[model samples]
Target: MDNNFLPISREDMQKRGWDQLDFLFVSGDAYVDHPSFGPAVICRLLEKYGYKVGIIAQPDWRSTEDFKKLGKPRLGVLVSAGNMDSMLNKFTAAKKYRSKDNYSPGGKPGRRPDRATIVYCNRIRELWKNIPLIIGGVEASLRRFAHYDYWSDEVRRSILIDSRADLLIYGMGERQIKEIAAQLAAGLDVRHIRDVQGTCYCADNLDHLWDYVQVPSYEEVIASKEAFAEAFKLQYLEQDPIRGKTVVQRHGDVFVVQNPPVMPLTTAEMDEIYDLPYQRTYHPVYEKEGGVPAIQEVKFSIVSHRGCFGGCSFCAIVSHQGRIIQSRSHESILREAKLLTRLPDFKGYIHDVGGPTANFRTPACRFQTERGACKGRHCLGSNPCSNLTVDHTDYLSLLRALRSLPGVKKVFIRSGLRYDYLLAAKDDEFLREICEHHVSGQLKVAPEHVSSKVTRLMGKSGKEVYVKFMEAYRRVNQQLGKEQYLVPYFMSSHPGAGLKEAVELAEFLRDIHYHPEQVQDFIPTPGSLSTAMYYSGINPLTGEKVYVAKDQHEKKLQRALMQYRDPKNYDLVYEALVKANRQDLIGYGPKCLIKPRLEQDRPEVSRKQRRLPVSRRRSAKRQRANKR
Candidate 1:
């Protein structure tokens, strides 16, 4: 496989080479700083190792022309299985839109460019049938088996089969990708690269293989998309040969093999990766086509850490970044901050410096060597773990240090800081420092739901905990004479939040005068335990029955409670209050709640003539009584 198939920038080709190359990287995402997507970073890393590399980005490689334009390569890497579901959803959505009798009302579902990976992989196969086409990233990696497709609601086979990729690399790809590039650079052939950790390849013959293999029953997975997604989730476990857990898969005549797991990149590797000379300005390529970026101008979100220790059921950080909590040293974060400040468009404040559960520092517990096991590294299943080392003294120190640096006037911890964790700050002085310095007007925290049952399901901090913390926070702010506000992030229609619970939550919000600034509807992002629960109504972790409010009307009512003060939404809130069986909230909702319209006074004869429904008639009667 020659690397020249990729059409490189003419300037880059003239400058970097005597041009025959060892590798070509292709991705469906715009190349950005940090290695969120595998092929993008892998291409940069190959260049670092002195190999000629070309990138075919956001390509629609559906035809032989797309492949020829990409150029033939010694090795080909297809890195998309994009950030969302497989591509079939687009066709499904388009078909739905075209067939709609009415112009399909307001919300159109989003779809992934699924055929990107399929087209690219199939085209590469056409160009050189046996060339080593390594497919990885979320799309290919998770699809490396016969699994459920949520969009299509059907069982689908490995992308390696569909896209015809030579191998599938799953999980964190830095170490595995680096090793792959190094091997190719050293002229090692692809066949001999067997059992490489974090690598999956199709192969022949599993009959002769030893060791216990857990091949999930096709029927069990096909029972439902949720069932299949659950089985698939469990199947993608970390393997450390040194730790003695490796999975091997046999695919027809070819075998998909995995090496002992590679420890995810440490903080230093993350720093080096982030330090890549990326043209950080938002490339309005989508905007050029008159489309907006899914996220507009999040120029401030630089990752200071690569992973998280929190295993909240509602989160995918643990699965995607792993629970390792690898963090860049203070110097690296400061350097990035300084660079951002120095940018010609220099914004004074750095938005945030953290990853999942931002305030949670690495090595959550000091007890790392109990019987040579890290007690803190694995907190996914354990909630409010006793060993949680959430002290913010170090984080506070980091924030203060950044604030004190040259060219930096302020540094806000705008990223999520776990309220429960902050409440547990070992040092009150640090808490005070956070209140005084870290927060700019408002501090955000995810007290996901007000209900304790929902909190437990979400693996989130409870409402009472947040209440207690809020009281303490108010006192601290008052004592310091600072008018800082606590911005609570709430989620509606999560698992177990039935109408009754939703009503209870609405009333709770009313009582506290705590109408949240933002109410997030449960989105059910892929690969998270919550997504499984949302899809199946059962917790994948506990296998316990869970209640998820999937009804659109119920979700709207709960969200409307968060905006009870808006005059335009008053009637909606009142109706929601009635439905939630919390009519008490109509008069005594949030202190700022708007008043609803009252029915005009009418005589008995006129009321009889109106012939309203019993429910509406009762509501009108209640309105008349309230006026009296």
Candidate 2:
């Protein structure tokens, strides 16, 4: 199977002696056999378990001909809008057309249409009116419920409703997919297949369901911001797999019921999924016009784990991957690294050996797996939880093994490593290991902001934790006789951050003598808490007002402050300093973010200087000008 991708054409399907495929996997991305693609994983998993699956990658959505190429699937059709939301993949944050798509062959654009899941499914249903359509992946999963659409600037109904998908499998879908496949194989009707966890479906009535909580209807949430906030809070609370209950929200006459998320896979299960004979590269079909560009970064990488516990306010990991961390076993990881060394393109370097948060290799607490994550709090946010399980022994051991593998020169932790977790580790062995062996040059960590108000709103630890982490990182590198550095990543114009907080972050950057080359302006991607705030100007959790930086000018100013040392940011930074009433910072003081304009560059100063006698005017010149 390594020599071949899953059958993408009818001839290839016949070559495998298949009369018809058990499923036809339709994706908005070109066919890539790598495990990173959801279509590849689900299709390959189905094949591994003896269900014939064929793929139709990026079918022409305008008509039914391309979908007809694969013929109707025997069991069902699985649809995904590539690896990202279609709207996001096609448009920039500024809503301009993107000319290239890494997920497409040759980095081509317009291969897949907007709202791909809905478009693809509509075509499929037109060709085969009653074929079961199950939609999953980022687009379907994040839009499983009614969500705020930044692009449309309106609240949209559940994607399940929009795509008319019979069922939606959300989150990382290994467990849910396997279970759903078995039930469907047994000849279950899509309408009656409601008991599966980590799934959502719609119905006209909900009398048959049990242990369900009803949230605000779609009409109410769309009509009122208050109702939207209330509904989102309830959805956020019950996301844990262990303790969550089935939740139902009314949309007109239809009831969209979401079952509890699928339980996180154990180490062995994760190992099996990754171990499935993945070719670990894009299919050869894409070799002509240059292979898929996205595979370049990941072909040499390993996904060491799934899920995250950091639960940043701006991130949607809590909703998508859940807060309970699930890692692959150390031996499983070592085996994969050894395989990477065997690849034709093998270099000595392994790009990354981590996922989501690189440092999280286990659950945050003893009870997080059997029970669920705690309510209204996180494992590491604002402050470490008293009961938090802070250890890095397993991750450290895994890193050591990969580096020791023959022909392996280096293994880097390119994924985001939670700095607060590093600070909370009771023993410093793991921190020491990363500093001594793994860091390529400078370790990147996200403190997000220094202002406590802003950090709290970002669901980040206080500045003191970042301060301690920085000292420890420096000390470890210094003791090891290494000249490595730390690159602190910050976010600007978050929900609670006003001009004051922006200036506070700028001051922290000044204190550290660091200037980020680029700063991320918070984009309100669907399903994030920060997006909820962006849409409603209200924190859903406490129902308190939040200051949203929505004005384009303010967003630019906030972003400019992050890179204030850049000469191009002078005007925006000046605006921020003045607006925050920190005009004292706009001068030539050592702490000033930027030097004040020269006398001639300022109209007032130049006018005053010109009116004075030559001797007096010379005093207004830059002091060192004549000396130089």
Candidate 3:
């Protein structure tokens, strides 16, 4: 066993000559001591600050026995549902159980319970009633408010209230956890520690809370859709760290008070966090079960920055990481890259070097550091902000230095690149360089949808911008004599996307001679503007009523249209075309999407095909070849 890893067993704690640990972490994920894993980062950061910490990963939640393995800690017990929300990890967009758990040993399923954080906390309370409980990470952070639950198809109370934890930390949690540990060490009562930023606590009265804006009560939001939309809008706008005010909401007799977000980490602070000594792999105990599968994707990857200003409505990046970008210095990243090269199994390639958005190496503009992100406006959405700073000089320099590393063969930018932001740059050097160096034959980008109305609702650039980006990509690849293809990711059944909009996307795919292998159906997870729209049928930002496809059949039809060429999707695609009154697209014309099914013998070619012009038949033949 590596002594560098934090103690996971009582024997390991004994080996460290520790009688009691300062903190014990409970997590839903298998213990992988990598920076990408939230539990590992928090535990390692605590260790670096002179606190003895231990972790219990994926404990059996059915009984209190597993929770007793690490015993009670001296200071507090930090809990998280791993790197992802447990509900999202356990189920798919269709609410079906996933076959495998990437964060578990042997890629097995059912290693953790449904609501892992609540379950783990309950088990811990069974053994030790008054242990200081802190819940952070993706599950608690996003569910720290009264929000909609897609799986239950109803509104649920805040996770902090349901889990009965003392403190709820949101965002990346480095700053919040450090402050929290210090206060606990200084002997502050957990219940009375209410002033920490980036945390949520339940209060009995409003006397202690100041400068706070109250949203709708939980009763009102559940009873009225309009009230729910209004509450979400207020919560969404005040997420800024600099100019944000404290937000309070009522839940029955108690009030949940959330302090303003923690200040963005400086370059030095970012450097210090990533510079901690991480084992960069799963614990050796899991080697027999083939190790944790999630580590494979990030073993050689590096996180260049955090947060995103491209406010896509369906995404939770702005809600969790906040919109302000906190980036590491080039020297810090290069140091990590050197560490990666020395790992025993490192093949020459560096998998990725990015975070939320790969190219966002700085704040959105000059004023963001001082004024914070505009209250209700996006830096790059339907319309780009005039003051948006679109520079890639620093990111390009970092990539160049990484490429010149001693043992690094190739460094890929696998993270999502905001093409609209890239296109907004004054120079094309970044695009040209990415085409020549970073791309690995296919560069995937998310256009989401092409319809103007749907794109507007999604807070994405319109079809024109995607087309402009595609053309520029083609031009750059041509100039560089590269054959790299651009793979655009599209989503279906999003709010405001009716069958008409779905067919428009299908037509665009048909015109471009592309057949998508997969299509993303929108899933309304918590803490996103799109989820509010999905629940209330109203866009929270705007008071307009939006069309939502709630029926499973409608969602299936919308998804099928994106892959209309598949034989299995023929029935759904045909039905969607008929319902949209687009039967003209069902004939033998050169521009038609699919062949019309015969009434008598559905498999036979119709007379429409025989009577077609030879040129049109050749065109149809070419189309068939392309689909193949």
Best by TM-score: 3
For model 2, the stretches where C-alpha displacement exceeds 4 angstroms are 597-628
lDDT over C-alpha atoms for residue 29 of model 1: 54
Relative to the true structure, candidate 1 reaches a TM of 0.80
Candidate 2 to native Cα RMSD, angstroms: 3.4
Ranking according to TM-score, highest score first:
3, 2, 1
> What TM-score, computed on C-alpha atoms, does each candidate reach?
0.80, 0.95, 0.96
Off by over 4 Å in 1: 1-11, 33-40, 61-64, 81-112, 141-148, 186-192, 207-215, 224-233, 236-244, 247-261, 282-301, 366-382, 516-518, 564-628
Clashing pairs in 3: none
Per-residue alpha-carbon lDDT of candidate 2 for residues 1-628, written as tens digits (9 for 90 to 100): 3587789887897888888888888999998888788888888788889999988998888899999897777889999998898998998766779899999999999999888999998888888888888999988988988899988889999999988889999997878888888888999987888888899999899889868888899999999999999889998898989999899999999999999998888889999898888777787888997989999888889999989989898888888889998888888888888888988888899989888899888899998987799988768888778889888888878888899999999888888788878877677788888887888788888888899988887888888888898899888888898999888888878899889888888888889889888787777888888888888989998899999888889888888888888878888888888888888897757988876665326664555556687677666565647777
Q: Encode model 3's per-residue lDDT on 263-289: one tens digit a residue.
A: 999999999999998988999899999
Candidate 1 C-alpha RMSD relative to the actual structure: 6.9
lDDT of 1 by residue, 219-316 (tens): 55556755554564454443222242455444444554554445656677877777755545423333354332432234555566765665677676
Q: Which 10-residue window in model 3 sums to the lowest lDDT?
A: 598-607
